[model samples]
Target: MPGSTDEPTEPTPGKPSAADRAARVAAMRRTERARARRRRALVVAIPTVVVLGAAATVTAVLVNRPEPPSLDAVTTYEYAGGDHVSETVTYAENPPVGGQHDPVWLNCGVYDAPVRNENAVHSMEHGAVWITYRPDLPAEQVEELESAVAGETYTVLSPYPDLPSPVVLSAWNNQLAVESAADPRIDAFLAKFVQGAQTPEPGALCSNGVGTPTG
Candidate 1:
């Protein structure tokens, strides 16, 4: 046959050329790399956000929490008896500040009944804050008083039949009397007087004392 100049035929319509296949694979790899990077970024970012959120929550709690009462308004009294006494004694204040007290310390807990005066006075010498409410006080107020003393290492809650005020917070040489059990001053008194500077005996035990647990 006579020769004429002619171009080669193309491959099948659906078949890709080698160069096109290579380009497409490279593009797919780029897309995959991009997606992988995004996944990793999310993995790192999620925990960071959670941690930040938790920190913010904790900060808000600390900021919003109520502060304890102040002790500046508490009245100071003088008493002489750093020593323990086995005999009955009388205190100038209805709830003795510091005077003859039982040899043992009263346990730290809520009390439904009145505690012995002499023993309680002894606990004051050992750096305990005695919180006494009138026996006739409303149960709700008593609960509030109990809340004040709960979980405190050097604090006691009890009922006094004839407390001058509805509630009296007594530490060694210091006394604060409030007519309300929910008085903010009660917290203040405990904050300052529990293991306070006025304590005649610091680091004395509040538990394992002579008194039985009052339910």
Candidate 2:
């Protein structure tokens, strides 16, 4: 018994065999690979989210900004009358070429007497007004026109019996001209008319053209 070695002992209960240990090591390696893949995905996802957020912020800043001012205000006029006597006048600032410009013209004169003496005057007289600034007109001109003509009355001419009368209102540097068969209260009509006359830019009432600024 002293010379004989103890019989080689069997592995303790539940202790893994060499092949089982190899399989456990392979399973651990697979778990680690899965964890590493998840880590790589998170890294890519974070940067992609950051880039999209930055792009959205930049787009909002560029698209919602205000535009710069590049246009000025211009003045307009209106005239009205009947068979008796027609007259014209200005509500705000008058243009330099009131009756002698390309777009502004005065067709005021007396016509031949009618066959019936009662309606014999057959007169045609009308007034005209407008505002103009050289291409370099100052911005203050707009304010000046508005202050000068805020509540003034101007003659409106309706040349023919079948034609409607014209209503005029001064707003900013522009004039609103409306034609109707009846007369409108000055204050009420002006409130609506001015809205159309006042534009943020300098140009014609209906179309864009050269003109002075109204405040």
Best by TM-score: 1
Clashes of 2: 15
Which regions of candidate 1 deviate over 4 angstroms?
A: 1-70
Q: Weakest 10 consecutive residues, lDDT, candidate 2?
A: 116-125
RMSD values for the candidates in order, in angstroms, are 29.8, 37.8
Residues 152-172, candidate 2: write the lDDT tens digits.
222112122211123233333
Clash count list over all predictions:
0, 15
lDDT, model 2, position 59: 21
Cα deviation in Å at residue 180, candidate 1?
1.0
Superposition error at 19 for model 1 (Å): 72
TM-scores for every predicted model: 0.65, 0.17
Best by lDDT: 1
Per-residue alpha-carbon lDDT of candidate 1 for residues 1-215, written as tens digits (9 for 90 to 100)? 36967878886575444355334434443434444466432222122235654653212221122334455667787776566778777767788888777787777667788888887887888888888888889986776666555556677788888778888888998888888965656655665567766878788887788776553
